[model samples]
Every structure is written in structure tokens, then in C-alpha cells.
Target: MPETLNVQTRDDFGKGAARRIRAEHQIPAVLYGHGMDPLHLTLPGHETALAARNSNALLELVLPGGDSHLALIKEIQRHPLRRTLTHLDLIAVRRGEKVQVDIPVILVGEPTAPAIAVVDAQTLTIEVDALKVPESIEVDVEEKEEGYQLFAGDVKLPAGAELVTEAELLVVAVQLPRVDAELEAAIEENEAAGAELGADAEDSEGESTEESADEE
Candidate 1:
């Protein structure tokens, strides 16, 4: 079920008006789509904040005149320092319609012992029912060996969902844990330095031999 919040229509505009709205503990929002004129509105700050926590929050907007509309949060503007909401951009949506959204991908279970699972992509773009958008998707890596990799298309989607991201996009890679990751790096640097020194020494020795041979 979708979250429901009562919102009041607004005629107020501009930064000054928005500041006034925020002072009154409300969020200035714009509701737009489906060929209708944009609806400027104010939503109670507390409720809006809680509902906006989820990326794909499906809100049933209860208007003052007893009409309601289903909307999805498209964008949220926030106060840069304090992290308070400044404005919201909501897009009207219809039930059963497919919408493209980025859903979080979570790793589940442990990969093969001593191997770390590195997630390359944190979220995946998918087309899912507007009303049934997922909160997150899980990828199980239990017993997966080192060198195992998972790509975007390897993810299992909820019913009626379709992948929007490229199929070849890497999602995760399982690799042997570098308990000595730093140590191994240091070793490689030292080996490279040693090789350079050895090469220079050989060149010097060759020059000395050539000088002696020329003198002879």
C-alpha cells in the first residue's frame, strides 16, 4: 500500500515565499504531469520528511477539496548545510504503469572464505509497476568463490519488473581478501625499484667492459 499525506494547494511562488512556507513547517512542492497544469502545493514538513526517506515513495496526495492523486517523488531540494528540505518535485503516476527507477542492490550472505565481495554498482535501473516499486533488491553470494562476478542482468527482479540498466554492467566481484593488500602493494613497488636498479647496474657494467675493451 502507498503512503498517504494530506497536502494543500498553494499559489505562493519564488524564494521568499518558499522560505515563508518552510518557516511554517511546510515543504514547498510542485506536482506535475499527465497534461495537467502544475500544482504548486505545501506539505507538512514532518510527514513529508518521513515519506521522502525512500527513493520511490508512492504517496497518495489527499487534496483539500477531497480529491486525491497518486504521485512519486522525482526530486528533492535540500538546504545544503542543514540537510532540511527546501523543495520537492513530484510526478503524478498511475497504477499498473511501469516506471523506471534506480533500486538499491544489497549484498546478502558471505562469499567464499577469505574472499571479499566488492559491489561495483550500488543501484540498478529497472522498470517496475508504479504502485509496486521495490525498496531494494538482494544478491546472494553465499559460497561464491574468488573470481566470481555478477553483472546487472544476473539480478533477479520482482514480478513484472524489467531491467533498464545495461546487461553487461558489472554489479559485484568476489576476490580473495588482501589481508596483505597493502603489503603486497609495497612489495610490488620495491620489486620495480630493484629491477630498475639492476638494469642500470648492468648498463654501467657493460659501459665499463666496453671502455676496457676499447683501451685494449
Candidate 2:
């Protein structure tokens, strides 16, 4: 089900207007798609933030005049320092229609012991029904051994969903963690230097004892 947010149309423009809107705890947004004129609007900051937690969240925008539109979040701009939502660009969508979206790829379960699972691609592009879009796609890596690989085409998708990403793209790989060669060499060099220092200290002590005995 799509999360519904009551939105208000806005005529204000420019940076000053945007700042004022945000000051009032609202987010400025623009909605455009399907041959319709772009609509400038303001959304509730708190509700929108919660709804946007899901990258591919579908939203139902209800206008004050009792009109509603289904929209997909196309772009979100955030403050670089504060990480607050600065602006949003939404695209209108319809139910039963196919839309292309980048869905997150999640790995489930652990790989075989001593092996680590590495993700090559974080998300995959797919075409699926607008209303039936999934939050994320899961790839099972349970008991996968070292050298095991998973490609884009190997990922399972919901019914009616088609992959838009290249089939040969690497999604996940299982491998054994190995130490860097330079680090290993540095460790050996440090051990050798410490051993040489110990030998020199022992020789100095023996010479001091011989000199003391000669003086006595």
C-alpha cells in the first residue's frame, strides 16, 4: 500500500522561499511526469522523511482540493552538512503500468566459514509494475564456498519483474580474506630490526663486563 501524504500547492519560488518553507518544517517539492505541467508543492517534513526511508517508496499525494496522484520518488536533494532533505523531485506514475527502478540488493545468511561475502553491485535496475514494486531483492549466500559468484541474472525476482541491468554484471562474490603483501613485508622487516638491536645490546653488555674485570 502506498503511503498517503496531504500536500499543498505552492506558488512561491527562489531560494528564499525554499528556506522559508523549510524553516516552517516543510519540504519544497516538484512533481512532473506524463505530459502534465510541473506542480510545485510543499510536503510535511516529518511524514515525508519517514516515508522516504525506503528508496523506492511509492507515495500517494492528496491535494487539498480532494485530488490525488500516485508518484514515485525520482530525486532527493539533501543538505551536505546537515543531511536534511532540501528538495525533492517526484515523477507521476500509475498502477498496472511498468516502471523502471533501482531496487536494493540484500545478501542473506552467511557464506561458508573462513570465506567472506563481498557485494559488487549494491542495487539492480528492473522493470516492474508500479504498484507491485518490491522494497528490495534478496540474494541467498548461505553456505556458499570460496570462489562462488553470483551474477545479475542469477538473482531471483518477483513475478512480472524483468531485469534491466546487464545479465553478466557481478552482484556478489565469495572469497577468502588475504593480507596485503606490503603489510606482511613490513612486519617481517620490523622483526628483523628488533632481533639485530637485541644482539647489539647483548654484545655491549659483554664488553662492559670484560672491561670491569680488567680494571679490578
What lDDT does each candidate get?
Answer: 0.93, 0.95
CA RMSD of each candidate after superposition: 5.8, 3.7
Q: Which candidate is the best by TM-score?
A: 2
Which RMSD does model 2 reach against the true structure? 3.7
In the range 58-79, model 2's lDDT, one tens digit per residue, is 9999999999999999999999
10 residues in a row with least lDDT, candidate 2: 175-184
Give the Cα error of residue 138 in candidate 1, in Å: 1.1
Report the poorest 10 consecutive residues by lDDT, candidate 1. 175-184
Model 2 clashing residue pairs (backbone): none
What digit string (tens of lDDT, one per residue) describes model 1 on residues 48-105?
Answer: 9999998789999999999999999999999999998899999999988889989999
RMSD score of candidate 1 (Å): 5.8
TM per candidate comes to 0.81, 0.86
